[model samples]
Target: MELEQFEHTIRKLFNKELLEELDDDYGFTNKSRGSFKTVGYSTNLSLETIESAAENNVELMVTHHDAWDFIYGLKEECLKKLKEYNISHFWIHGPLDFVEFGTCTSLMNVIGIDRVTKYSIYDNGDVPGVGEFNEPIDFNVLVKRMRDELEEPVRMWKNNEKQVKKVGVLTGAGHSSNYIKMALEDGCDTYITGEATLYTIQYAQFAGINLLVGSHTFTEIYGVESLAKKIQELNTAIKIVKLKEDHFELNH
Candidate 1:
């Protein structure tokens, strides 16, 4: 219940060495409460999410991604509310990305896989994560599988009719041609990620790789949810609320 207690538990489960490598922080650790009864979880430390936590009376706010060291635009606004409500904010970044039930693995699990092998690398060659699928599936069927697991529609750029045997998942903003190249080299017929650029579409067609691109926010929800579930299982008394923004779709 203490700040030290919460952080200690997190560090133990997520690995202290990884946390330091990511420079993960307790965003706002000061509070008068002896113990935290509720936890608010979000992907970013944005103004809207911070306000939602305060309104819900959440004692601690946990964000899976941390932007404080890079982005400063919304920090002041978010801090005002967090300070006012005496809510503590903490970030669990790279450590949560490749855990046993991490972002990439969770996606593969939802989409269904016979076995998994880690692929993507992060933090100086450490494989943060990627899943290797054994069964070859149709491109369209793979897209449907991704959408079914995401519970949201995905925008796809289909290239050759190659049945997808090896699929690589990177979760958010992982739609670059470079990643596609990696997939191709690794013999992946399809690359599944959150968002894509116009250039990548044509590239995929030429490279003969299929892609499933969905909303960034939508693709990134699983990691935090999985973490919360584990945390709650360990500490049955804390209330964990996942605050999410509704899907915003744009069409032209």
Candidate 2:
């Protein structure tokens, strides 16, 4: 498939224009935009890499970063680079996190969780940030189950205290500090996230809520990667590349 054609399809599938409208800036910021060589501090490639990719006729480029950052000068530069290589870029950024059945939903599903509830206070809201299990599970068992199902070790911020019936999950970042009070207000016994900060762990301990950090990239990657797989399955003509990149650093 032609690169632009692939991008067109993806734009339609993701309602890309609507996304752009919702966040005029597309939530672009100066913070790190994943681990791409073109983005990170330790970039190894040069103009020649772009030349080589162009020579290879690479069709599609998937990025973890949003292509709308003011500092990065995204849209023009991205399209220019991709056009030179005859490649089209489909970006999934905040939309990847905000979509109802996107990243957080995928995480809950993988952990056999259900009946997601939402919380919005101080103008902050998300679908998967807060949820409840179908049935109550012991805290220890829940941790073990999450570890086994995600196939990644889990880090606990609080001891196993009470049975977890209602829980909150936020993919990537401690975000616990932002949502912890809201989760508590919503009667959640435990809060789950992909990465946690030291103060967040302390907050969890004091907040009387169980907290778990399951690794940053390990959590958020599930949704986009799954989208890529399903797209590949439906259309044999297009190629899918799951960028093997982890840009965030979370210390356990």
Best by lDDT: 1
The whole-model lDDT of each prediction reads 0.72, 0.58
Q: What's the true lDDT of residue 142 in model 1?
A: 74
TM-score of 1: 0.86
Question: Using Cα atoms with residue i matched to residue i, what is each candidate's TM-score against the true structure?
Answer: 0.86, 0.68
> Model 2, range 1-252, lDDT digits (tens) per residue?
443444454555556554665454232222222212221110111233334444544344444454434546545564566556554444465666666555676677777777767631112444336778778988888788778865677887554467899888777664647567767777889888877777778788888999877876667666666556555654566555444343334343
Task: List model 1 lDDT by residue over 1-252, tens digit each.
Answer: 677777667866776566667664333433546579898888777777877888888888887765464575666666666788888887776676756777777777778765677634464633424455576777778788778867777888777776777777777777677777777777777778888887778778888878788777667777778887777877888889988655654452
Error of 1 at 165 (Å): 2.4
lDDT score at residue 1, model 2, on the 0-100 scale: 47
RMSD of each: 2.8, 7.1
Give the lDDT of residue 132 in candidate 1: 55
Q: Clashes in candidate 2: how many?
A: 0
